[model samples]
Each structure stands twice: as C-alpha cells, then as structure tokens.
Target chain A: MKMLRNLLCSAALASLTATGAMADGHGWSLKKAAAPYAGTTVDVVFLLRPGYEAIEAMLPAFEEETGININIIKHPYENALGEQVRDFVAGGDLDIALIDLVWIGNFAENDWILPLADVQAKYPDAVDPKLDMDDFFPLVLNAFGGWNDTVYGLPFDNYSGLMFYNRCMLEEAGFDGPPATWQELKDVYGPALTKNGKYAFALQSKRNETQSADSFARVLWPFGGSFLDANFKSNLNSAESQAGLKFRQDLMQYMPDGIVAFDHAETVNGFSQGDIAIITEWSAFYSSVVSPDTSKVADCVEIAPEPMGPAGRKPALGGFSLAVASQADEAEQAAAYLFIQWATSKANAREYLERGGVPARQSVYEGDDLEAFKFVPALVESWQDGVPEFRPRFAEWPEITEIVQEWGTKMMLGDVTTEEGATEIGTRMESVLEEAGYYSGEKPLAQ
Target chain B: MRGQVSRKTIFAFVGPAVIGLAAVGIAPLIYAVWTSLHFYNLTKLKKVKFIGFENYSTVLTDEVFWQAMGRTFFLLVTALPLQIILGMSIALVLHQPGLTLIKTLCRLSLVLPMATTYAVVGLLGQVMFNQKFGVMNQLLGGADINWIGDPENAFAMIVFWDVWQWTPFVALVLLAGLTMVPGEVEEAARLETKSKWTVLRYVQMPFLLPGLVAVLILRTADTLKLFDMVFTLTRGGPGSSTEFISLMIQRVGFRGFDQGLASAQAIILLIITIILAQIYIRVFYKEV
Candidate 1:
C-alpha cells in the first residue's frame, strides 16, 4: 500500500515538476540565462559534509549547463563561519556566502550578503521570477535565510533532526519498535536496551555548536520551552525549560559513558559501531548511516521523526543558505546568484535528492525514492513545523551560544544544577542581548 | 680602527634585525594596545569606537576570564613539576658515565613525542583516552574512565599528554647542560662526597640551575599560551573546566569577534606571564 501510494505521489509530483520545469524556461533557466556570465568563476566555501558532497556530485551538470567554474573551497563545519567571516571582512574572492542559519543575522546585519531583492535588482538576468520562493519550505526558508521580512539567502543544504535507530539492536533488546516519545525512550527502552556494556542512545553533546544546537536547544521546544519569551527576555529559567533540561540529565544514564564530549561524528560512529542503539541526529547524515563503508549495521538502520515530548514533537533544525556575497563584483555576483538559483531550483531538486542533497522544496519530497531514503518522511514531518529561531538567529547569538555551550556542558557534567545552569545562561544571555541593544531598542528583535 | 665604533657600520649590521623586530613585534603590540582601549567588535566594525579602558574593566571583572586563569594555573602547576622531575631523573641517568649508547638511544626516543605536532598529540590523546573504544581503556582492562568528558579527568589527561610530549625536550635540555659540566669536576665531587645526593645538590645543581631556569621560562610561556592541544583534546570542556586563558581569549577575539575584550584580556595575560617569569627567576636565584 505504501509503495503504491508513493508511486502515485511520484506520478503526480512528476507532472507538477514538469510544469514547474517548463515554466523555468521563461524566466531564468540556467542554460540560457547563465550564458552572459559563462566564463565567470564563482568562489564559495563548502563544508565537508554529506549535503555538500551531494551538491558537489550534482555540480558537474550545473557547470555544464552554465559554463561557470565553481571554485570550491572546503572547510570543516566548526571553522567555516570564521573562514567566511574573515573572507568577507578582507573583501576576498568568495562570490557566494555560505551561511549557517545562526549566522544569517550576523551576515545580514553586517551587510555581508546581498539581500534577495537587492541581488535580483542588481543582476536582473540572474533573477528567476519562476523560481517560486514560496515553493521553499516556509519554516526552513525563513529560518536559514530570512531576516526582518527580507530574504537574504535561499535555503540550500538543510537538516531536520530525526531519530536514527538500529532496528536489530532494539529487537535484540526485546523491544519490537523504536520509542514513540522521549518519556518512553527513558522509562521503557532505556532500561531494557542499555545493558551488556552497550548504550541505549547517544546525544552529541560536545561543547561548541553541537552542544548548543544538537543537545541543548534541541530539547527546549518539544518540552514547551524556548530560549527567549515573546518579550525577548531569557526564557531558560522557566519551569518548562528546567524540566526539559532535567529530563535530559536523567536520560544521560542510558547514553555512552563519555557522551558529554561526543559530537555528531562521535554519536554517528557510536551508532555505526553498534555501541549505541539510537541517536537523534540530523537528516543530512542519512548517507553516512546507510553507507556500507561507514556503518557496520547499515542494513538494520531505520529512521523516524524524533519522538514526542510533553508538548509535542519539535526536532533540531540546522542548515546553511547560499547568498551572493556583497564583496563580489557585479559579474561574479550575477554568476553566484545564478548558481544558487539553479542548484536550489525545483527543476533540479529530484537529481539533488537522488544524489544526496537534502532539498528544501516542498514539491520535491513527493517524488520517487522517498522510501529508499528512510529519513525523508521523518524529515518532511519534522520540518513541517520547526523552531525558526531554534538557537536564536540574532547577531548576538554567537556570543550567547558560547554561554549556552559553557553552561549546557556544565549541566551535563553535573558541574552545575539544571536550575543553576539555566539561571546562569539566562543571566548571561540577557547580558549579551542587552549589550547588542535588544533591551534598549538600539537593535530590534531578530529571528 | 679596531677600538673605534662607526655608527653607520653598526646601523648597517643591526638595521635588518631592528627593522624586522619593529615590523613584526612593535607594530602589532601598538595595534593591540590601541585595540584594547576601544569597543572593537569585528562584527560591529562600523560601531567600533574609543571606549577608554572599558574593555579592560570588563575583563578584570569577568568571571569566565578568572575561571580560565584558575584552570590555566592548575594545569601549569600540575604539568610543569612532573615534566621537570621526570626530565631531571632521565637526564641524571643519561648523564652517568659509560652510558654513551644508552644516552644516544634515549635522545632518539625523546624525539618521537616532541616531533609529533601539538594538534596530532591532542588527537592521539582522544584515540587513546576514549572510555569505550580507546587503547588506554583496553590496556587497563576496560577501565571506564571518561577521560575527555569528566572535568578532572579531562584536565589530568591534558597534563598527562603535556608531560608525555614535553618531558623529552626538558630532559634533552638538562642533558645538554649536564654535558657542559667538566668531567673532572664531576669525578672530584663524586670522590669527595660519598653521597651522590650531596654531589648532585652542591656540584650538579649549579650547572642545572641555568638549564632549569631556561625550562621554567619556556614552559611558563608555552603552558600559558597552550591552545591547539586543548582545542583538539577537550576544547576546554566538560563545561569549560579545562579552558585556559589562551583558549578563552581566542574564543572571545576570533569566535565571538570581540577583539577589544580579547585584546584587553591578552594584555592582562602578558602582565601575568611577566610576573610569573620574574617570580621564577627570583626564586631560582634565591635557591642558587
């Protein structure tokens, strides 16, 4: 029944995409529109991740369609923001700014990336009227790129956190299915599964962005918590927030011994090595989890939407956007914009998904091979509703995130009580926001 | 001609070195001092302005800054003594007569850890010290030590790795200093004082003092500025338990883009390093 439904959906999606593809020729299809900037070189920094590698796989066609050379510079996820920031400050040769969702405010406020409207006006030929910005998943599009009702970037490589679990491991532990809720995972599966020196789950709680995004902020929303209230005051001290954190503290027992130091790589490797049964990881890691080379139990891995919390399911949201660099000259900017439009276009979403790229286009999800990639259904659902400001996409968030990373890790390590940690974070976070002029109205609220 | 010093000749000989020093050292120092006084956040470049020692004031009162200082002090005190003692013991054994081949072999062995890069040593620490899968746990018959996750263990692992990597260099330095001792002076001391301890204290201590001072100065600077190893190893983590002054400053300046605050913190660190170095020199002189 599922296969038949997918087949029918694929057919309907094909016609919709065909209609969208044909409409592309009238506005800014790469083959014709990119002709003027054919020889131009578009320099962009790409992180060494599955999504970026997937994009790289689909790049040859992009290059062929438009005679543009993408001068790809690779950086690790931890360092890419710094590298891009330095390049922007120095007026270096990055034509396209690869922006982490958290960095959108920083880059946009700094006027480092050309706003979508500004870029369209500046480079008319590169503007895709038929590109249909509305086609982008509203949550992802806004979160990854939007700033103060202005879109600065198009959602490109995206992530929605999902539960990747080993079905075999769960079955062996005498549980027939994955946990349906966070509470269930702790109260039921955790005790049943975490035996024989193996862990039931792992949270990538390493200090840095991982601790902030993957571990710390991940819990808040589902438990009816958030970093800041509607008035922009620190919301971490609320009982709801503390409950979420306290729950995480309790869940730590089922995790690996040194999990407080584990990052996404470590957690994924743990799942791969059969050391852990389940992990709530980004959907972008689907390729790695399924690959025979990286995973020993590749065949047994199953992915589902992150389990429910007291309130509901709100999973981790993280990814980057691509925008034309403000530093780029008109020609390079046009080429960069052209590339962004082409790569993220609805016409190209199918190949992108097939290769490995996690496209944010709503129309693309219904296309073929939805079942093959087990994470996509979970991804679509998780991404259906998301916290756009999961980590608080404000210019001051970088500084505040450091505070969160510090206190969040301390909380996990038992250095500070959950309430104490939350209180500290709230105090420090308010200080940062106050400095950034959030309280004084020097700067308005950022998403 | 031999006694007379020509100014032009002196300038010609010293000009390149002076120019190089001024360009690399003096210029950056001036810039840092200037930056330290301002509200110079890199992200808010347009808003950067002269705030007049406000950054310094912030640094002085900052709790995190002091915590980092405390951690740095702990690491330095923990690692340096171990390195010095181990190096001294290894150096003394190597200094014994008729152990030329042993000395050569020991020196060769010393190069291995020193030659490995700081970042790689940090990575090696992770591979070895990992609780579940690391070699250290396996070797210890499944000892469940959260070497990187636990606060105290993480710091201790750093100290352990620090001693492992740097002890070799310390031993080599002391051995070279020991070699500078005259063979006859050593033999005479040994013969006169039946106690090896007395001979080492009175005779060998004099020569080793210079080397020891050098080690103290170098290691003081090295430990204070330690970044890469900790960055790759624990990242000042298990909740900033191992974050040193240098790591904190880098995050402030580079990651947080608060250049002014970082500069102010750096200047403070510089003063602290100078004070520590002075104390070392004065204490060593008193001992001598």
Candidate 2:
C-alpha cells in the first residue's frame, strides 16, 4: 500500500507538472497569490458528470493547499439543475453551483447568481486579465456565462455532440466510410441495420436534457427550423421542423424498439453490449465508448462526422458552467469565485482534459495532446458552428421541457403526426413564452 | 377541585402530543390550504402573492388533471371490489384445517408479496408485463401484446399490480375474522343440515362484516393515493391514460413547480377522502 500510494502521488505530480508546463508555454501561468479568504471552508456543489470523477479524485490536493474544505454535492444528471435552482430560490446556503450552461439565463435573470467581475478583478495573476476573455471558444464562453453583456459564470467541462459508428460493421456492409449527407445516410446505410436484433443503431429518446440536446434540437437545426423564431415566438409547428421529426421517426426503423425509454446509460450499455452498430450522442462518452475495458467494439470503433441534413451538419453544445449564488455569504462568495477560477484555469483544464474532460478553451482544442481525443476535430467543428437551441433558458424551462419531452416521446412512438405534435407543442410553447414575457406582439410562427 | 385536578393532568399529558401534531402535520396542512388560495410558482416561491380561488379554477380546468383524477377513480372502483373478493376467497381456503404443509406454504406465499417494497413490486410487474422482453409475452409465444403501452391494457395492468401487491393484506384481514367465527355456531348450523352456501351466507359473512369493512376502508384510502406502482410502471403515460391524482399532485408541485395548483388539488382530494371515510364508517358501524 505504501509503494502504491507513492506511485499514485508521483503520477499526480507528473500530470500537474505537465499541465503547469503547458500553461507556462502558453503564458497563462502565474505565481501563487497572497492567502486571502484564508481558513475559510466553502461548500462547492458539483454535478456528477463523468469527467469530474477525476476532479473528485484530485479534490484532497485542493483542500490541502487552500485549507478550504470543499463539500461536493453530486446530484444525478437529470435533477442537478433543478436541485440547484431550488437551492438558490429557497435561499439555501450554496456557495457555488455547477449549473448547466443553458440554465444560465434563468439563473442570471432571477438574480440567483453573484456577478464574478469584481471577484475576477482582485485575482489578476490567478485569473489573467488578458486570459479573461481570450483563448477560449468565444461562442460557448459568451453564450453560457455572459448575460446582458456581463460575465456571470465560467465554462467548465464542455462537449459538442458527435457520431460514433462500428467501423467493422460498415466495412462488412460494403462501405469504407461514413455517410456525409442526409440522403446518403438514408440510401447507403439505412438498410444495413436491423431493429429486433442486438446489432442495431441507437438514439436517445428519453424525456430529459439529453433528449432536448442530442435528439430533438439537433435534428431541428439541420432542417433550417428552430424551437423559436428570430422574434422568440415558438416555431415548432413549421414544415421544416416536421420534416426533421419525420426523419427521426423513419430512422427508428433501424434502431432499437426500446429507444423511446433509453437514456445515456442505456445507449452506452447498448453499444458496449454489442447491441448497437452506431451512436450519435454527447462527445463526453467518446473515450468510454472507445476504451477497451468498457466496450467490446472498442478496437472496431471510429468517430464519424454528424450526418448531414437539409440545412447542414450542426450538433448541439452539451456542457456545464460555474456560477456563484446570489445568496452566498461574502466569504463563501469569494471562495466560490476562487474555486471557479482554479477549476477552469488553463493548467487545470489541460489536466482535466487529459483525464477525458472536453474543455471550453480553444487552446485546449488546438493543442497537440488532443489528437488522441479521436473525435476532437469533429467536436471542434460542431462546437464552432452548432446552433445551441439551449432549452429556452428561462424560469419556465421546466414547463417548456415537458412540452418537448411529452411531444418528443410521442413523435418517437409514432403515436402522433409530426405536424400535429409540432402544432400542439407550438401552441404550448407560445403560451409559456408569452407568460414569461419573451413573446411580444409579433405574429406567431407558421404552423 | 377534583375536576380541576383531572383537567390539569389531562392537559399536561396531551399538550406535547397536540403541539407535536400542530408543528409537524397541522401546520403543513394549514400552509397547504393557504398556498392553495394563491398562485404559488416555485420559481417565484419567495415572491408568491395571494390570488384567491385562481389555482382551484385552474385545477378544475386542466385536461391532464381531470385525466389523472379519472384514471385514479377507475383504479379505485375496479381494484377495491376485486381485491376484497379475491382476499376473502383466499382467506376462506386458509381457514380450512387439513394439510399443514400446504396451509403453511399458502400463508407464506400470501404474506410474501405484502412484505416486498412497492417500488420493487412495480418493477417486477413491469418486467412481467413488458411487451418485447417479458415472461408474459414469451409465454404467449411473443404475440406482441402491448400490456403496459396501450391505454386499456395499461389500466388493467396497473389494477393487476395493485391487486397482486395488496390482496394478501386483505386476505390477512379476513383471516382474522375467519378465526373469530364461533365454532359452536358453525357446528350448530351444520347439525341443522344447512347447506354450505346457506351457512356461509347466514353465519360466515355476517360475522366477517367488521373485517370486510376494515379491508374496504384501508384499501379505499390506499388505492385513492396510489402513486408508486403507477409512477414506476407507466409514469401515467401514453398520454396520461393511467395518471393517478397523487402523481398529478407531484407533477404540478415538484415538476411543474406550480405549488398552489397542486395544493388546491390536494385539498380537494383530501375533502373527498374524508367524506368517503365518514360514509364508510357510518355504513359499517351502524349497529356498533
């Protein structure tokens, strides 16, 4: 146990050194700051996403250095945002919350989070002034954390959706490549898979964030349709949207019958169990799917571009952000900002990505070490151009989520016409938007 | 002075209990009532302002709410009678005294289901009734029956789940009544050459009145608030075909974050349950 402990420590030290070197080369490193907020124990809430398993492994080091005991409250992926929102609303003591990026609008608008500008002002070297708005993926950084032209949160672990396919299966089916267009997808590859058999394509259809992120909105974007029109009116009932929905329903023929109820675990298990030949999901699962221990087809796996639609190949951005709660005590508030800066720093992000985290930094994406990411190229392309139909980030998102989930499930189940479902959804979405004051005296989108 | 002392002692003993109930239960009940009279959205939980009777009006008008209530009523009406009849039959069979091993096995089997957790029972029920990969489908040679997916079939499956889990409880209740039926009365009726049906009708059932009432009252309250099995199995899906009122309340309050509407629905449901309880007590204990 002693030798094992030393080896583990050495490994951690080596990774830390490598990250520090990377940061130094990039001119993003700094000397340690004066111990302000010393001896303060702050409660930091972390949503239990996969990459954070490494951070959790390394938390004792942070605690040892800072003398601040971090209390990690890991919520299930499904209820994490809801729980954070509830905590903030109830005036519960949450020093920091790792909120989903899409949920930032609601958090900021409701004044549930403290502005981080002042905190960022104090720690110049710890959080470089030039680096504050530079070297990061501008779209992701600005969209999620910046509200009303002010930064209120920081991007943590970020992901762009991508496609995975069984290379062996494709090769055996008289193809040496992946489909590049929607028509080609339907024509060249549609008939190669079976439904009842274990070796089928799988897609998420569960009624949650994954559904909204990966399945529904991803499909909608490629069809030149969106959940909301330019004027923020619901446009779900439009012809373009219906066409996209119909495409997904048609694709269900080659997928598992249990797709309607499948979540991330089910989809991952299906692929690992050799039950699926293809998967299109969040890029975070790429490493696990290609890891030999976790997947049987690991050796035979290959990352492919997202299948093209009428509009283009656009995938949704799926990730989380860091925020300080408005209700935190002053000391706790300072600690929370420090933690966010430390957590998202260039050095930390590199170490994080090496352990399979997808960083929000453009430098990380462009780095040499990321070549092993396998899908990094596609992930970057998608992230840069993706139309993030972020779950209508408003106070009424839960209600709007239900509208999408219930109708999305119906569309998947073939229980309703896409046009009909979209019409109903549009009506409900309009009402929610109107009630939330997002919709003005504009004509509703075409049904 | 004696009366005063007695009153003082009673108040002293009961004070804690009264305070405990008020603090734990009655306060929440009162708060729920107060909230029910307003528009309590969780997002605006802190800023919740009074808007009397609006939530109630909304509850009465929501299509999904009515659907949930309808499904709940159907479950209560269908499951209650069937549960009692089946429970009484099993109880009667167990009351017989001949084969010790068989009797013990039967009693054990009846108790085993009740001992299992409701969530586990719901899951087991789903597995049994699963369309693609279920034992029921396999037994029927994979005939593609949508047991838990179709509206009519899902309702029947939920009712079946309820009966399977709780019929044993009903049987246990009736078994107590069966044990208490006087042997002399039964023997006397036998000696008089009364038919088996006649003896059962005249002696057994009348003696089991209180037990039967107990089963009804317990099952009525339980079936009215059925949430777990239905929630786990169907999730009140296929367009809310099997939604129960409890599930609706949870959705409105927790999922929808519309606390006032949920509270209003709860208040209405409470009044109904109370009225039903009083009526059942009056009908069952008239002689007593």
What's the number of clashes in each of the models?
Answer: 0, 0
User: Which candidate has the top score in lDDT?
Assistant: 1
- What's candidate 2's i-RMS value? 3.1
lDDT string, candidate 2, B192-233, tens digits: 875877877777777788888777777878877888777777
> Considering every candidate listed, which one attains the maximal DockQ?
1
TM-score of the first chain in candidate 2 relative to the native first chain: 0.87
Shares of reference contacts reproduced by the candidates, in order, are: 0.74, 0.11
**Candidate 2: pairs in clash:** none
Model 1: which residue pairs collide? none
Off by over 4 Å in 2: A1-39, A122-132, A439-447, B1-5, B98-112, B120-157, B190-197, B229-234, B238-242, B278-288
At residue A363, candidate 1 shows an lDDT of 92
TM-score attained by model 1: 0.94
- Give lDDT tens digits, candidate 2, residues A60-132: 7676666666778877776676677678877887888676766676677678886555555433334443343
Q: What is the lDDT of candidate 2?
A: 0.73
